[model samples]
Target: MVKVSFSSALAQKEVKKDAESLLPGEKDPEVGVPLRQPSRAWCWCMCLGLALMLSGVVVGGAYLYRYYIVEEGRVFVCGVKYREEDYIIREEEEVQLPSHFQLRKLEESIRILEREQVALINVPVPEFQDSDPADIVHDFHRRLTAYLDLSLNKCYVIPLNTSVVMLPTDLVQLLDNIRMGTYLPQSYLIHEEMVVTEQLQHVEQLGYFIHSLCQGKDTYRLQRRDRILGMQKREALNCHKIRHFESNVVVETLICEP
Candidate 1:
């Protein structure tokens, strides 16, 4: 009986030990969660890394767009100087004076009559000035007459008076004037008339005509016309003339009728 009792006690002890092992004690502090499950800390780190990579991509794209686009095709104006000999044709006149004196007049003319013509249209003429107005005017008339005598017939000349011209004080008042409003069309018509009358042969003759017009009193009209047109367009037409430096040529540009 003693042997049987000892054996029974030993079996009971083994069962108790097996139950304790299966139930598992308070969970291990070090391995509280399963190793297969992702940790919240690791998930947050992954999200932060993805966010950084995305931001980098966006920033790089913006930089490339700015560098490759939006900075081309700009117009710049530069000034150049030319000499008298560059003109296609030049003429001289001799004047006989008292006491066996003689004066040689240099007449510089462009080759508007040639087949290769350069066109000048509606160029603004600057105002002229005279320290002694009467003497200058007389001299202008004499030179003009002499020019007309040549009968070149390839250009029309409009003389300007520099000494008497001024910019308009009130822009509105200036616009009301008929002379300034129709200057361009009138000039165009004048050119056309000259062409029709056989006074100007080639379109290029217009350049010479513009140069001549800019020489004296008529430039004021051109400038006034340009200013009026600029105001109407809401742009500054302050630069009234366009010049081709190599050719000693000037023309009208940037003025548009409203």
Candidate 2:
């Protein structure tokens, strides 16, 4: 730094002499074009160049905004969220797409089921019976879930309007309570008795469960089995061959033989 400063100081003398030689009254100087302010045309040209550059920048920005921003998400869709049915893959967004083959297969099954009119009844009820609407449907849905759990590796809700016909045990229980004696139980509604399709055998089992639960152990027949069933009993009967035509599961009568 000190050496640079000393060199600059020595050069200042020559610079001062050059300045003195360029004064108005100076003579015997090397002739050259005199130093002057920039020409008006040059100034105008510079201003025009800057204006054109700024305009070009604005036009390029407008074109990019229109192409990228305005053209996004131009597809129609429906579902929980208002998203495009056909989504564009984006760097910032993550999406888990459904398997096309699996989805198509499932849809095909549903369509086939839908085409087959509602399942044929298992048995004829002379008159419609009154029961808790919620309990019956929920129990049936739950029964189907348990039945599917073993055979099916994946879980999905099967869409159907399920109506299961069951034997009335509530009335029998009331009668037993009034008479102060244990009543003998009857066998549950089985698939053989109903007009059920090959697809709906588990639903028949569901009917059996409903009827058995309605018995409520008021009869001597049910007491021993329920006591025996103990903690192992479940609302659903998990059958491996539920849809198989060859297998038959007749749920035991809760009541003892009279």
Candidate 3:
């Protein structure tokens, strides 16, 4: 590097020249100049634009929220109306049977006999799902009155339709009369089938007998088909039938998927 010393007179002349060359309001560059400030009108304009964008977002969000609420309300109302109409139609078309309690009392009358060597009362309960294990039970005495479900390891009594199935005493007496030749007993075969339908709610109200039959399962309805034709035809998909001779009557209870 090169170093040179300036005389006092030369340094004073250079400072005077720089002062004379400066404009009235301009600051000297050696001391650093401040940047130009933005106008008040430009700052206000930017703030207004941001506020308008935020307001639009709030209004759009509210509109979407209200739209979804209205749509959901409409769907719920329509579903309720449809269910009401369906209930009315069903009531008119079908004859209501006695309540589950009445049926349970009748089932309780029949005794639960001891298990036989070979289990025969293997029947599926309602709402049979794909994942459920193989549940089989035996109707040992050929009475076809009660069964045990191996899945739950519980015994359930089936209510006999008095209008259809004769009482145990009457059934035994009929067999004796046939043997005595009191009258020519015309024997005919009948087919009875059961299928899983809707879920059975309020199982507690059905009493112990019915509760065991319908417990952990859906409601099953008997589907009566022509004896001759249905016996020959194949059963439906996921359908299982259990046939047993109860002295005088041949009973077949079919359980199927819902």
Candidate 4:
């Protein structure tokens, strides 16, 4: 509802001039061509242009998101200046590990094993009279089994002398008892106790069996074949004697792939 105004002087002047021009009775020249309805094609072209512009914006935004925003972290890392001694791994190489290194590693390994052996041997008798001494035996059996299994399967070579062996069925069953966290039948347990006074003797035999497998070899090398060497955590004493153990039995064995 805006009111448009024309200049008063210009309007008056134009009216006077027109009046003077029209006195001769000459018809006024045609003012202008009348406009017709716009063609449908023009409307279609405008819509098409708008659609194209919208599509271009969407595509550009996606490109910016992926290569600029998403990849910004990797780009920043690549642009960083690094020191020469930063251990940038560009290529793979096989470096022969030194004998001294092997010695040091084995010494550390043996120290840990010895500590574990001592811990197993000196298991404090449970304060409760109902507790079983055979639990100590179970714990030792598990460790020895791990050691044997590593020697048998994993090539975890140590500086200590060892002998390779194909384990007998009886020994295998005993090892399984440790893995399954199971006990032998009462008759079998009684028979074994009668045969050997100390469960520690069984451990010694297992160790001897493992030692014999080394065939007097002084040095052995372990090449990692698997992505993981496996994990090592001691199992808590199994009082439940549940046949179906809740989790996968984790055994810490000498470095050998079984």
**What is the Å distance of residue 216 in model 4 from its true position?**
54
Top TM-score model? 3
Residues 1-258, candidate 1: write the lDDT tens digits: 355345888899999977876876556467767468888999999999999999999999887754443211121222222221222222363432244432211112111111211211221122221110110111121222101211122222333322321122221123234233322111100000011111322323334334443343222112233323224434433321122111213212221112
Please, what are the lDDT tens digits per residue for candidate 2 over residues 1-258?
355335787699989998997898866657665789889999999999999999999999998875555333212111111111323445556656554412100000100011111111121111223110111111333332111212222111222313322212322233334344222211112221111112222333334333333223211111222334233444343221121100011211111112
- TM-scores, one per candidate: 0.19, 0.19, 0.30, 0.21
Candidate 3 yields a Cα-based lDDT of 0.40
> Which runs in model 2 stand beyond 4 Å of their true positions?
1-27, 30-33, 74-258
Model 3 TM-score (2 dp)? 0.30
For 1-258, candidate 4 gives per-residue lDDT tens digits of 999999999999999998988797664577555679999999999999999999999999998975455423210000111111212222364434334431100000110122122111111223333222211111232233212222122111222211211122333334344444333221100000001011121223334333333333322333222222342223232221101000111111223222
lDDT of 3 by residue, 51-72 (tens): 9999999999887864453223
Q: Locate the minimum summed-lDDT window of 10 residues in model 2.
A: 104-113
* Deviation (Å) of 172 in candidate 1: 31
Tell me the whole-model lDDT of each prediction, alpha carbons only: 0.28, 0.28, 0.40, 0.29
Query: How are the candidates ranked when ordered by TM-score, highest leading?
Result: 3, 4, 1, 2
Decide which is better by TM-score, 2 or 4: 4
| Residue 114 in model 2: lDDT | 14
The residue pairs that clash in candidate 3, if any, are 121-137, 121-138, 121-139, 122-137, 126-218
Candidate 4 Cα outliers beyond 4 Å, as residue runs: 1-32, 74-99, 102-258
What's the lDDT of the predicted structure labeled candidate 4?
0.29
